[model samples]
Target chain A: MISDTAVESDTAVETQRGLVEIYSTTKSFHGNTVLKDVSVCVKPGSVTALIGPSGSGKSTLLRCINGLEPIDSGVLKVNGEHVGVVERSDGFYSLNRKKRALQRVSVGLVFQHFNLFDNFTALENVAIAPMQVLKRSKSEAYETARSYLDRVGMLERADHYPSQLSGGQQQRVAIARCLAMKPDVLLFDEPTSALDPELVGEVLDVIRKVSASGKTMVLSTHEIGFARQIADQVVFLDEGRVCEAGPVEQVLDNPREARTQKFLERVFG
Target chain B: MAQHPADLMESINKPRITRKTKTEKTAWIVLAVVAVLIVHTLISNPNFEWATVGRYFFGFPVLKGLLLTIILTIVSMALGTLIGLVLAVLKIMNITPITILVDLYLTFFRGTPILVQLIFWFNIAALFPDLFLGIPFTDIGWGINVNAIMTPLVAAVIGLSLNEGAYTAENIRGGFLSVGKGQLEAADSLGFSEWTKITRIIIPQSLPTIIPATGNRLIGMFKETTLVSVLGVADLLQSVQLIYSRNYETIPLLIVACLWYLIITLALSYPQKKIEDRYSKHKNSGGKVTATTEGVKLG
Candidate 1:
């Protein structure tokens, strides 16, 4: 159903479930520019893979989408509201810390390093944010967390602390943590990059299941084959710029840009 | 290829024990002689006055002083730690004016001797004859006489807590820094409010680093309460001095005080070890195993 609507025309989608649009967004750290005038429109319920070499701004773009990294220029809109920035009658102004925190509730991010809260059990890590930020009752929040953990096949390890679990188990729990929030857009910054070879399958399988659930996902990854299989649209970023972006088959199978072609050959060949 | 159990046991016989070297023997002899001499001196010394020490060890005045010392340590350390948490948060937030203010407070309290601080507080009446509690440079507030409010006991508590707060703040700041940047970022991405992030995420992970150092501070605070004796707070040391002065039995009274301190110090150490072990349990079980997973190849 989603792909049928997506194929008809991207613009005709529901405004309430509209595309996550990034327009001319740029970001920098200190004096070094990390993302330079990047733009992409990710359709709701579609999986968008951002592929690039090291320091190619792929991770930066993923961070910018979820308001973890503030853009220096242009706008990022999730559903319809501008992320990290509030538009007032006078002009645009960055949201204050509290307001920004509230705005972030609609987006969830999975990190490369699987940064689970060390002191908490897997269940507590998933349950805490909903109880604290969303004001859900303790029982209800924990129930929701357990359901998400079940979805990610991590229910058995719910009581284990992050350090006690395997890396892939931790990442599965991390994914479950994001899912527990019921976010509109799920952003993964190389989620599988930190897992073991045998363990990588477990986390990827979880992400694949999450994607099938119709939550919009934007991920930056070095997994060429995985991206080719799951992504509806693939964007190749190089040197803080989007060198190529289009349908997954066109971009991954028959890339038009030299940089994209070279990246693919180096990874897939 | 299987062998009899008896034959296997015989084949795996343990190596013979070796004799102690000359240096090891000499060290043992020295330690034995020192132990004997110390015990002999303590038992035989006429100046020790074993009866007086035994009587005064659980006597009314010394017992009262011990109770006071315990109270002072608990109250001051609790108040100081609370203030230290606030100062640590302020410093970590990096608000320039507040950070500078915290730094100045830390430097002033930490740089000066505890004895001097106690004395200064006891004489606060000289610095501010009238204490005001309202807007500065305005006559809109009421004033109170300082001498009535700044009693020696109050002054002692104020001095000890302020000094302890500075040290605790530095330790807490170190704890906060020891938490990885990725952990903070993870918390932020989870939509954790700043308060939730600090209370739930940062402080808990930082505990392993902070607890051991804070334990050291707690014991130090217990010992440092003796400084309040200079202000006539009638603490353990002060109580001993009072008795010694009255009866001219200084050595036995001093021994009583030393024995009490040694006993309390030993008592505090057990809890500290338990807390350290509780926080560090994960270190032995899980962290190293995942690190080796980095080299595992994935397609």
Candidate 2:
């Protein structure tokens, strides 16, 4: 279906800037193919939610998109530039560590377990990357960090370390940390999965605000309701394949694939 | 409405009661008695030659020797730490040839005894009479006379630092490993260069694990400096030996040296503990509170 759309709208692809384009990407660990020929296109300033069961390749697809995990075959590009690999005259060549790291500057990722730097306070956690990676002045980075922390409603607790904050607060700070980087694309892999049930809403609310700000985002989530509320497009995966892809209503409410239907029914029930 | 809620709350809010263990009192008494006995022995024993200890404790020669010992400890530890950090980073980088080289260095330095190392370093002039100080594989540098430069003091510093570097490297490597894999992934996602990631993230986060172990190594290093006395470098112990050999007051001068070591060790321990406490504060208070006053609700 994605290839069919690509064929139909080849001209449209050129105009779309700062978009994530994953075409027939295959990733495997050992003998197990975790992501099999997955194609996901995240348009500029839009949220695409990937919903699937555990071990259904949602996380793997997100990781591959950000170049955190290398794909076995196929092209994975963020903001129209290849991530983790470069195309040569002969074939695709995996980039060296330094070049790959430079390519990752355009993309950001939020993990399920909020991986905030424990040694730094919440504000420093958000600010350090901008200062170090972007070569921003300390004051400029801190100001940007304060603004993002305010956006996440964590401004007052900016002085606290990750250990002192609850799971929900840590995730909010993690989101703010990613935002401070000012990447063209953001990927969230089950951002709320490791959070306590009651704490999930605060993080989701912050994400909802981010989505409204019109940043390009791709999130793999188990929260069906939250995904439906925020995502412009929804992609459903089953056993390493994208089973269905369309508008949120079509995928969540009127899924055509039997697998997506079964999965949604089980999730909704 | 039989009783007021305030009274009921007061009744339940009494101070916590804990039973005192009878064995603790017994142990305290035993400890006090043992301490008194030791003090009495030190004061009353004529063999101690307390006057001689006092006379030489602050003597010029002893003070000079003490200064050298302190210098050796500080210089060797600082050099060793620098070497350890470089080696640890190289090991983490995992370039096969460099790793093997680091492994060989660690094995040679740590496997041999310090005494032997000191002696060997003092005699290194025998093996290499002259050393070059410039570009390798080409005659582009000045030649250094090994015999002229390799003094007892230099040999002691080199021997102690090399051995300490091996141990410090292991400690620092453990510290780096103690950091969670998640931290590195987060840094990677932010497009941090390898140097930035290690310097800004890995090193800072590993401090809580590194600081306490490094403190232990530091205190050990202070005591280990005494071993250099055998090389006749006139450190604290060597000074005491010189005096005792002249005056025939071995036990008294030895007591003086022992007293100075104890006092300095105690002094070093205080700051070591303070640094360890500062670094590990987060670990102690983690999960004890929430970001907001909603802590009560969360509970």
Candidate 3:
């Protein structure tokens, strides 16, 4: 476990890895708002956990940071570059599909369903994006893929297809696929939410190993204990609003807001 | 836990009791008798002319017609599939003008009879005697006589291919629609370009659905080529017609054509089954295959 003092000292030195800034971001679907005037800052080399109820917009916020879902109104910036929209002299203009896709190369998202290509083997799933999107040579992409699979302890099953693997094994491969892109920011949306109770530990173990490398990560999860152990900054959201945001100890141990305390009590007790 | 190991072993080793299945035995005997009776009647009937059927089975005119029929089936199916793939993609794009144009093409081809279409193409020279190759509304162009090019063979190919294209387009569009939305989102999140997404993710995922349907179309096209004989093309059926017309051995010549069609259909069916088996292996595991194999049994 990383001590809070060490995380603060590491944040002291600024690096251009993954810097996410969301300002008054609002999103809705069919006139029903999901994220209402939400603002959260995730500094580089820090793991920020968005802990909230099911409909509290944690997943939507993570998706907006990766440009998976477009925001209705507000500014979203990652590493000083606007995401999903471009700012002009007049106002912000939505980026075209092609341009938005190009911007997504630096951001990686791990879905709750694993979403591995059913036609591809584990190694192919990890290697395909590098070969297709980045235009890497076949040998080089395979080599990078093997290294990541090895990191996630999935190298032995590289030739196996998605259906051949269990949920935990598949999520580990999904993580390797995300890491193979070398994205500066990683977003995990309930990585273990779909796994069996016995399988959750394996995926969380891989996530813990990833956090030790000091990569920028934002994950929405229901596991409050795991969030306390891994997240440096914790943001508690309720009713599509951030009720409390601070250091892990401040938010989890000593929540300032009544909603945050109530949520923690319900989750813990 | 209550039973002794010796009693368990003895029970497991005993011969299993089986039912007689009396109805199944009776059905098998009845079917065998009916089959034997049919064979006896066919052999005894003199008008059937089994010898004449054997004689013309490999006759020169029949062989030539078989070759032409095979050629027509292959060419038309290849052209039809290509056109179908393009139209399916355009329909999926859903741009108003392009989609409307594609729909109109599909409707017109599917709604009309292929025989009429073939005859129309055969007599197209009456409508337009010359075909001009140039930009629309431009005076600078060269002309080619339509009658020189619109032979019966050409007309048959065009009619069969265009009509076949409409059916395949709907089949392929169904295949495209069967792919899950999660696959597309995964492709998008990986920063895949539209072309890459379609070629790599969408097409590959939809293939298990497309292949079985396409196999049925191939076999149907083989039989459907018979429609071309009305245009005076020298396909298998036309060759048989020419021979029987000359010798007046209509029954035997028709038998020969039927046997050949059956043989070719059986031959094509083998490979289709093999490909379907290969694809179904993944289909069972992925659980994304919605294209039924019901048509395969018919083919």
Candidate 4:
């Protein structure tokens, strides 16, 4: 039976602040450990950037947060709801579509490729979650989609399909799609890394605006300058572990970890 | 446009025949052969039985059987497609025993011949005198009986639908697999549930891949209906077989069924082609397909 309270519970959980927390999260794929014994927290109104090099497990960390990738062991809680796992060896017991979708709404995610549904126009793509999954009426979803598109300055391109738009336009539409769901925390897994060099600025600009609007965002990005500008805290990941995590200025300016020093030198030497 | 092969060899030293010249030469050759056959047949056989041909062409049994064949084909295909979709989804899921059970179904249906399966279903009363679906030792409440209700039409539907289900599952699975995993992940992150992911994003995008296979299956199913004549179901082929066994005119009776099948096939194929053309708008045209599709095979 479908319940009318799913959206209402989700909204209530999201409305309460300082509720998202992760404790001792660890993940592996094909018996190879990717994120090992990871623990992180996102405050209600803070921007945290996960910065690292190739194969540093930054993307894995982000995916674990959303339960898209299963974690081998962990107790990750988003808005007081457990995700990814209930027990270490036994695995997740209550991992149903309902709970997974509920977690997705609370923590909206964007991928490296702007994986917008190419079959739908931008407006339909934006309206999808609200109307279909969240059970909002069509008109209500469309109005919200319009507002989010306007927020990303993509209102003009709402009628175009993802294939018809440029790389930056598609990414912005993806952002608008996340926004339409009104997630408490937005997770980006190298969102701008897939864009062309010329198109990068347009997408980073939208993220910058979202950050300025006080949306709590956790991003894994190689854009050093954007991180310096927008991030409140930057966590440096190296070989499936958090090497250095602190104030953006402290980590960028004075790294206590030798590996962080080496990474910063490689990025900004 | 009017270039002849003998004259064309003199104009340009191109060894390959010009398009118009080749067409004209082929046309003349075909016309000459047809004319010779017509003259020879006319001269040899004066009484060719044109009246018999006319009577069989407008025969009542043939017409009625054609309609019955079409109805069976439509009903069976529609039923098969629906059951196949459910089985395909069940096969793809992570539930341990269900996936295994669905795989077993695919294997048995796909590996066995359709005619054998039909015959086996028809002869089911002998094998399982008492129908039940419970554990071997435990008399549980999880079974249904087989003796009383497995009617001939029911058995035919069961046979056709089960056989087609296996092939449809493969087609649907292929279509689902062709859509990138990123699309599902993206829909996942968008807060779309599993069902929503399928109905909204995956299915719509996969339409381009699934529709062609589905149309092909529909055509195959249409012909597979003739296999039901073995069950004595009075479908088109059986109806014609009934009449021709008496008259002893095998060719004319076969011709009547053949013409009806051809007409139905052509009618269905027009819409199938239109659908193929519609969904094929985004297909990668740089590569080649077999001659069965809108492509050519050199060998």
| RMSD per model, one decimal | 6.5, 6.3, 6.9, 7.9
B1-299: candidate 1 lDDT, tens digit per residue: 45669978787676788999999999999999999999999889888899989989999999899999999999999999998999999898777999999999999999999899999999989989988888888889888999998998999999999998999999999989988898899888888888888877677667667877889899988998998998999999999999989999999999999999989998999998886775566445645212322332111
**Tens digit per residue, CA lDDT, model 3, A1-269:** 46885676456424545899899989998998999989999999899999999999988898888898988888888876789888889988989888888778888999999999876778988999999999998989999999999999999999887877999999999999999998889999999999999999999999999989988999999999999999999999888988899999999999999889999999998
TM-score (C-alpha, index-matched) for candidate 2: 0.86
Which pairs in model 3 have colliding backbones?
none
In model 2, where do residues sit more than 4 Å from their true spots?
Answer: A1-16, A89-91, B1-45, B136-139, B287-299
**Which residue runs does candidate 4 get wrong by more than 4 Å?**
A1-24, A87-94, A256-258, A265-269, B1-51, B126-154, B285-299
Among all candidates shown, the one with the greatest TM-score: 1
Q: Each predicted complex: what DockQ?
A: 0.35, 0.41, 0.31, 0.32
- Write one digit per residue (lDDT tens) for candidate 3, span B1-299: 35669978788778988876999889999999999999998989899999999999998989999999999999999999999999998888778999999999999999998888889989999999999998889888889999999999999999988888999999999988988887778888889988877777777778888988999999999999999889889999999999889989999899999999999999999999988887787577564422332232100
Best model per lDDT: 3
Per-candidate clash tally: 0, 0, 0, 0
Models sorted by lDDT, best on top: 3, 2, 1, 4
After aligning candidate 2 to the native by TM-score, how far in Å is the CA of A177 from where it should be?
2.7
Candidate 2 clashing pairs, residues 3+ apart or interchain: none
Positional deviation of residue A27's Cα in model 1 after best superposition, in angstroms: 2.6
Model 1 reaches an interface RMSD of 8.1
Which docking class does model 3 fall in? Answer: acceptable
